[model samples]
Target: MESELKIVTFNIGKDKFGLDIMKVDAVIEYEEATTLPNTSDYFEGIINYRNEEVLPIINLRKKFRMPDFDDKTLAKVIVLKMDERKVGIMVDDVKNVRSINQDLIDEKPKIGGIRQADFISGIARLEDGMLIVLDIDKLITKEEKIAIDEVVTD
Candidate 1:
């Protein structure tokens, strides 16, 4: 039997990306977040989730240095479970869950001049198009992680 990996697909602009479904908690509609000062540009802000938890929203496009979408653009927030905490990532749109064979995933290439390319774990070939599989754990740098920790703790 082939090893299958489930992933949640989303779009950041025209580029399609996928995250391991195991790491995903939920996919929610985008909501206005309370802006925070002294935070990174990609750090959108925090949003109250289900009146229980405060979720920090990150702009994947900004983090990847991609073109920013306008406020009018429809977006979705993908809640990711990381390090015992939930972090929300804003994407242009949420696609759907897909099951891809582990053998189909190709190692990410060394793409020069692409910011955050290192975060890509591999590239999955789908019938429609290629899907960039992202490794969420490596998405943020150590310095950024420290800053995010400080903000979340406060």
Candidate 2:
């Protein structure tokens, strides 16, 4: 049987990327993240979404071994769901949504230095250019998730 996929397109650094929109609920503005204590460097912490507390997000900067954040770089959050629990994924910005068939995806080139090259599911060449398709479900794990302790609230 043939299957179709819906992808959410976005940018990180200078690169264009996409993940299945099934992995996303909505994209929202970047706000101050409630910082967490003694956690993985990737974890930026948590935020409040419509009364429900959810993880704020991790920046690609920290993920790619760049220095800690400064105030200049603008950002946004990609909201996701874990069962009924809500979470946010921080990205440079949200782009748009697009559809691609399962057969249309091309293989990602084998590369070193960036472990994430392996994390890419496939490269989808669109009318304009290429998009790095990601395996969002494998982006992290439950065991890998660390709780945030927001000072003002907690």
Candidate 3:
């Protein structure tokens, strides 16, 4: 039987990216994050969700080394659960959820010398264009995870 992979699509710069729907917890409107000091450039800081939980938000554009948005009014945050940790990834905009057949997904491409390529899990060949599938867990390094832990604990 052919299985389908459901993904939440979002725009970062001119490219479209996808996250496995299973990892996604919520798609919320972008809210200003409280900037933290002494963190990586991509670490946008933490936000309190409904006064119940605090999530560290990472600016995907900066993390991918893409150009920054002149205005961030249209930005959206994708809340994801990686294991027991919940983090938010900020994107230009949220696209839509799509279910693509597993057969349509190609192996992660061999992009030479691109650091960002390491985080790509695969590429889904949709009728419109290719969607970069991201391995959310691999997106953050061990050190970054420790930093995020510290951010959440402090």
Candidate 4:
């Protein structure tokens, strides 16, 4: 049987990336995060969503070592669920959900010496351009996860 994988596509600067749709909880508008102390630069602090849940926001631009957008009000947040934990990823914009055939995805290229490249699962070739597929679980390091867990509990 041919497998079809669905992904939520988002933009970070000029590059387009995709994450497993199953991991996505929701896509929300940008909200200012309360800065946290002792966290990584990529950590955009925490934000309360719908006045209920507090989610740690990760700035994709910072995480990817890209410059921040001049105007953040236009940005979007993609809420993702990894295991039992939830984290929100801030991006330039939320594109659309796409379904790609397994055959269309090629193995991620070996970028020698770039350890961060490991998070890239595959590259999906589309009519317009290639979409970089990221392994969401691998995006956050163990240390970051521990810090987030600690922050959420506190």
Which is better, 1 or 3, measured by lDDT? 3
Least lDDT summed over 10 consecutive residues: which range in candidate 4?
A: 110-119
Which candidate, 2 or 3, has the higher lDDT?
Answer: 3
lDDT of each: 0.87, 0.71, 0.88, 0.90
**How high is each candidate's TM-score?**
0.93, 0.79, 0.95, 0.96
What's model 4's lDDT at 118?
71
Give me the overall lDDT of model 4.
0.90
Question: Quick one: best TM-score, which candidate?
Answer: 4
Tens digits of lDDT, candidate 3, 1-154: 7599889998888899998999998999888889989999999889898788989999988988888767766889999988778899989988899999989899897777775577788999999999999988898877889999997898
Model 4 lDDT per residue over 77-111, tens place: 99999877889999999899988998989999877
> If ranked by TM-score, best first, what sequence of candidates would result?
4, 3, 1, 2
- Clash pairs of candidate 2? none
Q: Candidate 2's residue-wise lDDT over 36-129, tens digit each?
A: 7866788776677767565557676677566654652478788875554556777887888888877778887767766655558898877778
Error of 1 at 47 (Å): 0.6
State the TM-score for model 3.
Answer: 0.95
| Model 1 ranges with Cα > 4 A deviation | none
